[model samples]
Target: MRFGYFLSCEEYSPAELIEQAVAAEKAGFDGIWISDHFHPWNDEQGESPFVWGMIGALSQACSLPVTTAVTCPTTRVHPAIVAQAAATAAVQLQGKFVLGVGTGEALNEHVLGDAWPSEDIRLEMLEEAVELMRRLWSGEVVTVRGEHYDLDTARIYTLPDEPVPVYVSAFGPKALEVAARIGDGFINTSDDADTVREFKEKSGGKPCQGGVKVAWADSKDEGIDHAHRLWANSGLPGELSQVLPSPKHFEQAAQLVTRESTAESIVAGNDLDAHVEQMRSYVDAGYDEVYVANMGPHYLAMIEAYGRDVLPQLRG
Candidate 1:
């Protein structure tokens, strides 16, 4: 299985993220997954730079393939614009980029003052968006009058030799069906084996990607504190994350999230055995790639540790 580092745009400065991308490549990571967000999940995480600009920096700094963990082409950005941006990124990355698309969360899309559509409507929009983007990527002059989007003679000139692969993100059965119908690959954050299997079954055995967040520190307790402080929003119940309108709302919901909840959700501490075991869960689940995000301040150390210890054992 391929191993990647998840660059949390919400947690790091643009320069720091770029540096980490370079470091991650040197430290034996196979690829990079960067979060595409307009706002951080919580105010404390505090940084969300334009992901496209950073992707350009990454292209210059490292050779590792990059993917937006998931971008919502249906809402905040029009599918036509996303097609253009993705086509440019693929060319810049020398065809080493994947456009990971999803139905999207309100936290980012709601900022445009558009009403948050229901799941059914979002799914419909996502299907149409993917279809439209693919058409544009093919160097076709797309003129569409769809239910959710409208386009007029859109064309992408700066495209790679081949169209960029699009991986759709899904957590539920309905979403998985959408991914199966349109995606070149499938992506999810959970390590649930059954869910992965279900996705594979639906997608006709397309490539599957998984992402996990971990906190590595001198002690497990320290890691737990860090995870709780910076990533508590991750543990919030389902649907809440998708519907929450603002980072402030996310922070409010996160108030009830405890340190123990973080410990359960996130792998923590410097124990090589534990970290390896956490990653093994994804590998055993038939994930083609598993991306790990270091949830604390000391990402450099985490990169070195994974390079020195975790990655080597995983190879064996």
Candidate 2:
């Protein structure tokens, strides 16, 4: 399976993000997944730049394909605008960018003070958003009115020479069905075989990608501690990202997670066993690729370990 890396919304400067993308590609990663966030989960996490801008920068620095895992086009940004951005990015990356999208989390969507809708409503919006984007990409004037969005005679002049495949990020059954129906590809962070299988079945044989986070270090304990301090917020699944109004909420929930939880969730302690186990689910589920999202400070070393200590065992 192709191996990739996730660029999360942690403490990464723009230069560092580009530097890490280059490092990941040089170390043999196939692609990179970047988080699209207006704010990091917490102040403790800090530093989120406009993801489209950074994708452009990565295009200049790294040859690997990029996916924003993911950008929600429903409320925060109009679907037409996202269409333009994705097309432009595809041009810059020479057709190596996937427009990964979802219904979005509240932290980013709530910025306009728009009331967050329920799952069903969000799915409805997502369907319209996808439809809108597809129409816009045909390089014709799009004038339409939908339940959630209305566009006048709008057109995108700077269309990409190549089409940007749209990848959908999904977690639930209904959402998975939507991804299957509309997405060119599917992306997920979990390594559960059954879950991936369920999604793939619904996806109608579309390409799939799985990504998991790990904190790497010489000591397993050190790695778990780092994971707890930095990524514990992820434990609260189902867009807990929507309810959290500010960084302080993340800070508070982050405290609820312990080092043990992280250890249980990820491979650690320089043991190839854990990483191997992590890859098994996606591999067994027939994913086209599996990505390792390094969750701690020592990303450089983690990529090195994957290239040296990890990949060989998987290939063998």
Estimate, for each residue in 103-176, the C-alpha lDDT of model 2 and write its tens digit: 88787788888998998999899989999998888899999978999999999888877667998888788888
> Evaluated with lDDT, which candidate comes out highest?
1
lDDT of 1: 0.92
Q: What does the lDDT read for residue 226 in candidate 2?
A: 76
| TM-score per candidate | 0.99, 0.95
Compute the lDDT of residue 21 as modeled in candidate 2. 89
Report the number of clashing residue pairs per model.
0, 1
Clashing pairs in 1: none
lDDT of all predictions: 0.92, 0.82
**Mind sharing the TM-score for model 1?**
0.99
Which pairs in model 2 have colliding backbones? 106-242
Question: How well is each residue in 1-316 modelled by candidate 1, as lDDT tens digits?
Answer: 7999999999999999988898899999999999999999998899999999999999999999999999999989999999999999999999999999999999999888999999999999999999899999899888888898998877889989998899999878899888988999999998889988887888789999999998999998999998999989998987999999999999999998987777887778898899999999999988999999998898999999999999999988
lDDT at 56, model 2: 83
Error of 1 at 230 (Å): 0.5
